[model samples]
Target: MMGNTRELPAPQRGDSWNTYECATVLCAVDGCDHGACQSGPFFVVSISLDEDKVATTIMYSSDTGTWSTPASLDLGFIESDISISWMHGVLSGGALHFILMHDDARLGVLKYDLGTSCLSEIEPAFEIQSARFDSHALIAPEDGQLGIARLSGFNLSVYWREVCHDQVATWTKSEVIDLKKHLLASNPMISHTELVGSVERTTIIFATTNIGTYMIDLKSLRSKKLTSELRLFNHPWALFPYFSFYNPDKLRTRSI
Candidate 1:
């Protein structure tokens, strides 16, 4: 019932990294009974990435303890289709966002504010099954921007959008832009996840089954693969993205 919390080791390529100390947690979004524990400012939800039904639910890890109990959600629980569920997403800037598709759930998108841990239904539920939650919920740089990708069966597509302030409604509205093509040319979002939080020189990094881990460096319009020493699976539970940061201050300090 105890989940693991690990930080990604330093990059072997001598890649320079920086630190902006923060805590992280991952959880299973499926209706699984998997427990979760966290060490700092994060929690993880466990869910089955390749199965159907409630029997596949697993444990979630927030910090370093067991989430024997998940705080009850106050909003309406619009049950998604039997073939749909939320297994993977990201936590950043006190906000937790995930892609919610399918007309059955009644809510197409959902974003939870970590500072409040309150759920807010975004838009009318979408009409797709088992889509990538992280792909569509990726936060973009330049601030207030977000990117999303969708995976329907063998088809995969990516999209880019920005969040703008709505004065009359006091809400941020979505505005799609011409950043990248919807990579339907091949399998893209299939079991892919965006890096939670952000690092300098990069907006998102994820690994796909057949196409090694792809780095989405928004700084430059190009994607690169980092060596081949690591092995990644499509399973959400096994997909661990540990980000290591280097700080000159930490190097000078005796204790980190």
Candidate 2:
């Protein structure tokens, strides 16, 4: 709720980032029983408000206009927090790829041939535990990457990397960059994931319970002050602002 913001038209889907895709994240607003939604280039997935059950749709946008009703992707049971990876047409020859990860350990990555409308699972070298794969998700193709930042083992700040190529595999641990103990403490909000952007190069945005809003740069492994504090009203209970990706320049953000 950025107070009485001008009404926005229901978003027509956005253009497909078939080019250099920058990492982007879509998270749930605090306290909405409607679960949350996360979208990648070709897919948008969500879960039941209170159930572990999940559903996903096959979708693509030629321009930043209308989003087709996403086609549901079938699964064994149900789950959430899905991450997708697409081919550059460089290594995989123009195929769309995605990884459906559930907190309960169920994970699968599928490759879809748009021309043929065929889907197949190409298992990875590792089991690819979805839970361990940081809840804070990001898909930044423009910056040449996709990743997430989270507090591993409680306090150490870390992220998972997406390996895109002919060698195709699961996410791998990144070079560990430590956050200052004094400046680093995980927030209690359910949305306690990392929010990063490349105003120049991903200066991450996170609200520290102690310090208010913070900006961290993963490329330089540096952290700095952004704001003294922000008053987020009626934060919708469970909906904390654990951002997966951020680009304040390209879009409008609301802060109450």
Candidate 3:
């Protein structure tokens, strides 16, 4: 796994009000990792509080090393309606989707359109029946569709957006993998696992517990242990593309 740490600068006079405060409150430790995205370039998306108005702002860097001015969305989101998930967002179909934990105990998918600079919310296709400990992830798999995984009990409920081009996407049940039926006998610790990351297009889910990290094949129901050392800390957002592992410049480019 790749590890990264960042330091926030002090609030400046011309900066947005609560710029430092929100960065401190929302991005404590690895929280910023959750709000960030990287493709050909890097971009950081953040919610900023300015004069009591909460607006989303983004700073992006291209192949060039310099960062552009922070751009804020014209509209604002409700502070009480949706709580942002502290997981790295899935970028697909020209939009970035962040998992939203709603006030009514439902998961909301917040999509920020890069083309239109619009923010919209999509309710989860299914109710959240899993326990609080059960993990949820938004993935852009190799098929170029938006995927969601809910690891509840002994099964992982996989949901996919079947029609990706529609204004209102359609989500359908993909598959349910029963982990306990396959691996619990070998490692009881599989009972308590959280999704940390995945290898895009590889059809493998990377999960970790106190014991170590393991990869489960989405099709074969087979799992392979990747690490055996006990994790000192678990940062689910501590993931970057392996192809870009050696390029610090790309990773450093866009951070909100």
By lDDT, the best candidate is 3
- Error (Å) of candidate 3 at residue 18 is 9.4
Per-residue alpha-carbon lDDT of candidate 2 for residues 19-63, written as tens digits (9 for 90 to 100)? 212122222233222222333222222111112222333433423
In model 3, which regions exceed 4 Å deviation? Answer: 1-55, 63-81, 103-105, 129-133, 164-166, 229-233, 239-241, 244-256
Candidates in order, TM-scores: namely 0.45, 0.43, 0.65
Lowest summed lDDT over 10 consecutive residues: which window, candidate 1?
A: 49-58
Q: How many residue pairs in model 2 have overlapping backbones?
A: 25
Of candidates 3 and 2, the better by lDDT: 3
Q: Which candidate is the best by TM-score?
A: 3
* True-vs-predicted CA distance for residue 222, candidate 2, Å: 2.7
lDDT of each structure? 0.37, 0.37, 0.58
* Clashes per candidate, residues 3 or more apart or on different chains: 32, 25, 0
Give the per-residue lDDT of model 3 (tens digit) for 1-256.
2365444332233665455222111121222233333323444445443443344545333343333344443324444444556666666676677776645545767676765667666666755523355677777765667788887766788888776555666778866787777557667765467777665545667776667777777878788777766341566455443433344445656568
lDDT at 223 for candidate 1?
A: 49
**CA deviation > 4 Å runs, candidate 2:** 1-54, 58-69, 78-135, 139-141, 153-167, 181-207, 228-256
